[model samples]
Target chain A: MVPSEAKKYLSKEQFIHQAFSYLEKGVEPTVKTLWLNDEIQEKITEILEHSYPKLRLRYWQHDDQTVWFLDEIGKERPISFGISVKSQRINLVKVLEFRESRGGEIHMQAFTEQFDQIKLTDDNKLNKHIDGITGATMSVSAMKKIARVALMLDKEVR
Target chain B: MKFKLALVSAALLACGTVNAAEPTNQELLDLIKSQQKEIENLKKSVEEADEKAEASVEAAEKTMSNAADSKLSFGGYGELHYNNIEDKESIDFHRFVTFMGYEFNEDIRFFSELEVEHSLSGDGKPGEVELEQAYVEIDVTDATSIKSGLFLVPVGILNETHEPPTFYGVERNPVEKNIIPSTWWEAGAGVTTELAAGITADFAIHSGLEVPNDGGVYDFNIRSGRQKVAKANADSFAYTARIKYTAIPGLELAASIQHQTDLTQGVLNADANLYTAHAIYNVDGFGIRALYAGWDVDSEQAELAGQDKQDGFFVEPSYRFNDEFGVFARYSEWDNVAGNSIDTEMEQTNVGFNYWPHQNVVFKFDLERRDGAQDGDGFNLGVGYQF
Candidate 1:
């Protein structure tokens, strides 16, 4: 079930609007939103724990979408965020875009592929992993970490 | 004349002087028509002459452009490496590479590579100058093209991917070179293409001729004293193909196969075949790679009976501390199948750091440990650029 307080957050249109507004504010937002219930959230949290041992996620609910942001405690500039959802049988994870210097555009395709393989269960982490592209390794890796954070966010926000 | 006419008019006034003026309306009209005809002829002649002059100027410009193009372009890439080895020879090698490309037209281009290896050797006793690659390429489209000439065999990572900065080490891994051959270029022709959704592939036919010169020998045909004085056949051919997939972000997998017939162009031809599978994965600051390659050679002059096969494997792990600096390590091992050589097995470890102050250039230092049967067991450091 969706949370009662989730309605206070932005809808899809409002979310897109706010995202652009935040970008214009000079704040690089790493955002992730997904749909999930409590039990799947717990399983996803376990998956993310292995993926991102150093990160903890904070999130909020807004009608149908679960909005999550990666909170960087000590860093400035070049922050990334992502979101994952687990409902019944399907699990989805996505990195909600970030800015990279120059060749960042080349990294997008590989990042998309990495997110598609986000599995919220440790029963097959190695089997589901992929080798990075020759030049886009860093961006792809950063996105993977953000996806993990998003999966963790699902557990807490739910 | 006018006074006489007036006198006669007054006497004949007398007569019909007034009726004489109306005699010929037709004659006055004909006089005006003749002047118009002369003006029209002049205008037509002027227009035709102007057109001829314009055509001549256009022809001259085209001729000049063709003369200037002559189908030529200049490009090259080089690397300098520095390294510290564990207990033996350390390596310091610098390479200066230059190539001249000539476009025969939209369909054909000729290319050649001239490299100064270990330039520090200086003057007479210094490093050698080698002709690394020479070939002609035909572009069918932006997505597909064919190249024939001397080229790197498409067997392993180092053969086709030998851009200095593309790999981790100051030099290529030992397994890659001993098993797959480094700086390997031969006469061949092949097709390379990119399909819809970003699938890339290359297929080529290469000359299986190997020059018997040392790695540092520049002009194989010109050099006098060298081991294995056999020249590469002008007509030997080999076949190669590589297929790659990028279905996932930050990940790519590729496989390559190559076959060369005999060491020379002759019947009962000796032949060599190589196969490889390689993959790379990236997650943020970290990268991981694994590759395997195998080679098989068939020759009646058995260098080693049943020892005509060689194979190897390698793995590399790397991390970028930040954008400008990174560290990487690699491990590899190879077994030589040529039974005639004293060196049969080789293993090596390489650790290196790279600094890229700019995108197109890099400075690198590599230290390696080799417990192998080759004089190449030393370390290498290099700096290379691409533009």
Candidate 2:
């Protein structure tokens, strides 16, 4: 697989976005999403070495042999998106977590068919997710993804 | 003077210089030799000046170098609590909680809070020592920072924001402690960010240990018995989230939730969940705070802790008479309706006074009463400090 192609069109964020997009559009993401994450991580390291260079992906596997990819990145601090696919349907969950604070979490609705995966959980939920922080939704959102990605990548290899 | 002239003439002859001179000629040669020596010394001084200039330029470049290197700082705070109960069956309670922190830099730091319940570290003693909160943090910016290791969830007022002086009386609110789990810290990492004016949010995934009510405290720290919060296809992990709003100046409000899957993978191992809402308001040294929390567990072990669906709330109002003196009262209630222990309810009331002669030190006296479950209460006096 050419890692360079995925890196060209997708920022690491874009790769994660596409992962959810496929799930929303009722299409299954190939193993390529995993490869895309690695490629972007490598490219990012070349440019932004001090920042975290890894992306994690997660999926939902239930008891009925049904497997759905979770678009959510990690459960730890640095929130991420959740993606799942089952019965021609994709479910996306947005989750957030912080280091010292408690209970600031936000989750958004499932997106399907025409909507891009760029949607946020909502201002009320975002406000709730951040607790007392103000004017940093985008940063909080990105941290959610990093948290999700770390969780996802850890899952894939294990 | 003659001796010097003779030496100069000899020196010039050795250097392939023919000295055909009278007495005045010798003196002129000596002056020339002295001038040459002076020039050599001047050259050495000029070379030293050039070296010094280069060194100064190097020092300037090193200024920002140390700026990026992490700065280390150490700080800590502690709590000494006391309680007095009006009931004849009551026993007084006292405890201490101290936290020491090291900030490596604005980017990262480490903090740990140690607790001694009843001032002993034994099964049946006056106190117990515990590493209450321990964690490492990597701050990305003022608005966002990632933290890992073990720490408290930002679900309510008492869990993460509990400092002795910050609260009114000896013990934390009942709703926050039993219902929301005060001093509840786990192993995980999450982020913190500001949402808008007077609002902030936090969430995390942490290690969840399944300790039955009968399970001793030691059960929480053992290998194989504990679970690591993993991403996917992993056996152990718990997800947590919290949001807070402070738009009301001295008034802060928050809500939080936590969920975990089958912890021990045994008979009746079920998911566990908790939710809470909290508020604190301070108007003109008259402070008031309230909290509500609920916990549910679908596990066989739930019976041991009487874990059904438990909901509780508390309201506290305090008035500061002056900078060094204040009086406060707190009322708390909890109801447990799940599990095998049957339905149980608890209520507590506390009246206390506080005196602070110094900014970092405080003294407190509290009288408390408990009714229904756990039928014990007492009075206590205490002192605490932070630095």
Candidate number with greatest lDDT: 1
Write one digit per residue (lDDT tens) for candidate 1, span A85-106: 4431113333343322111322
Docking class of 2: incorrect
In Å, residue A97's CA in model 1 sits off its true spot by: 23
Q: Give candidates' CA RMSD values in order.
A: 22.4, 21.2
Q: How far does residue A154 in candidate 1 sit from its true spot (Å)?
A: 33
* Alpha carbon lDDT at B38, candidate 1: 81
DockQ of each: 0.11, 0.01
Runs in model 2 with CA error above 4 Å? A1-158, B1-70, B79-98, B116-127, B213-235, B263-267, B299-306, B337-343, B374-378
Candidate 2 has a TM-score of 0.52
Per-model TM against the reference: 0.53, 0.52
Instruction: Identify the leading candidate in terms of DockQ.
Output: 1
Q: Rate residue B148 of model 2 by lDDT.
A: 86
